[model samples]
Each structure stands twice: as C-alpha cells, then as structure tokens.
Target: MKTIERRSTCPINYSVEIFGDKWMLLLLRDLMFNGKNSFLEFKASDEKISSAVLTEKLNTLLNEGIVTKITSPKNASKFLYMLTEKGIELVPFMVEFLNWGSRYNPNGGPKTLLEKIEKNKKKAIAELQDNLRSQRHSYTNNPSDAF
Candidate 1:
C-alpha cells in the first residue's frame, strides 16, 4: 500500500478521500450488485469509464485494501476483482446510498430491490454483506451461486 496524505484525522474526511469520486463508488456498485469481476466487465458498464481511468481507480482500490485481484481460473490472461473484508463492511453504507439514490432518481435503480430494501433494511444489508463475504473469489451473477 502506498502512503496516503490526510487533510485531517476526521473519519468523514477519510471516507471522502477514499470514495468521494463517482468512479470509485460506481466500480464498487458494479462489483457488489452486478457481479462484475474482470476489467473488461467494468469497462463495459453503462458509465463507460475509460481504460486509463479504470486502471488508475482499480489500482487505488488495491492500494486502499478495499479490493483484491485474482488470476481468473478459467482464463489465465484475465484478472478478477474481489472485495476484501474491509470492502464487505461497506455493504451497509452502500445499501443506504442506493436507497437514497432510488428515492430521488425516479427512473434509476431496480424498483423490486428498492422495495425489498425499504421493507426490511436490516435484513437486506445483512443478506448482501453475507453474500459478499461468502462468495470470496466467485463473482457469479446467479443469486443461487452467489448467495
């Protein structure tokens, strides 16, 4: 991990420094919800992040101990990204963030998911966090496989 400069010792400032950018959150969102693992999958997201930017952000995530890269078992040439325990802990925050976004953005986000989250926030967060932690390196999109 590279040395990071801090503006202050505030936790809020620390979070902002780590995840203030849209790209970082989007990358995490894709990883958590979309079951995206490879660089190509991230590149093909609706956000259309550039390769250079994606590489830089992914490296930053690696350095921050939030994400880890693994050699894909099926493809020697490709690498798959997985969330660390630290990253899995962010599941609650992400669930709330998604709820907030879905509340304001009428056309965005999954309505069914939003309803489930609204119905039981704690259960939703717990289920997601458990799923992320249990999956480890398996980034399958199938709910049965992941859960």
Candidate 2:
C-alpha cells in the first residue's frame, strides 16, 4: 500500500493527514450520527456538500479503510456505505470532539445529545461503539437502525 510522505513521524500529524478535512468529518458525522447509508442522504446533510467533494472524501476514506462501500442487498442498483471496524473504533474519539465542541461553542447542537454525553459519558460511548461494531453482520442495518 502507498503511504503519505510527511514532515515527521508525529502521531498527530499522521492523524491530521488522514482526517483533517472538515467535509470528510461531516460525512463521517452523517454516517455515524444520522445513519446515512446513501449518497443522497449524505448530500442532503445541513452542510450541503458538493457531489465532487463528497466523492473525493469518500474515496479518501475508502482508501484508508475507514469505511466500506457495499452493494445494497435489497437493491442491487444501490449502495450502502458503513464504517469499517477501524472506523467504528473511532467512535469514542469522535464523541470527544462532540464534547469539546459543545463545551467551547456558544451555540450547541441538540440538547438531548449534550445531556446524554454529560449524564452518561462512558455509557454513551459504549453504546455507540457497540452499534458500529455490529456492522460486521453482513448487509444488515440492524446495527445503526436503533440510533
């Protein structure tokens, strides 16, 4: 596999090189938060990402093995995109970002989400991780559907 040449071996630099884009993070947000499995669904996000940009970000994540695109079993013409095991493992980190943003930003997101994160921080992360981990069960939305 090809690797990105960077200035140093710092872990933060490596993480940024792989996932620094705002749009890509939004796509992951949609997948992990909104249960968006379709291109249309991703495109319909509040951020309104352009088709070209979305395609590029998806390809990058796909290349990094952070996500997988599989043909929809219910409809061959469609595709379902989900986080890979590696991506699923990022749930806690992502949740931490959410927590950080809610803390610093004056205008917070959903109150329910904030309250849950505050009230049962560990439990919330565990539940989310459990959901994404279950995606290995072939072609089933059973994992993310509960969210």
lDDT of 1 by residue, 17-132 (tens): 88999999999999888889789999999999999999989998999999988766666688888999999999888888998898799687977777879899898888888887
RMSD values, in order shown? 3.6, 3.2
Clashing pairs in 2: none
Q: After superposition, how far is residue 41 of candidate 2 from its true place, in Å?
A: 0.7
Q: Least lDDT summed over 10 consecutive residues: which range in candidate 2? A: 138-147
Name model 2 segments beyond 4 Å from true: 1-7, 135-147
What lDDT does candidate 2 reach at residue 109? 70
Predicted structure 2, TM vs. truth:
0.85
Q: Model 1, which residues run further than 4 Å from truth? A: 137-147
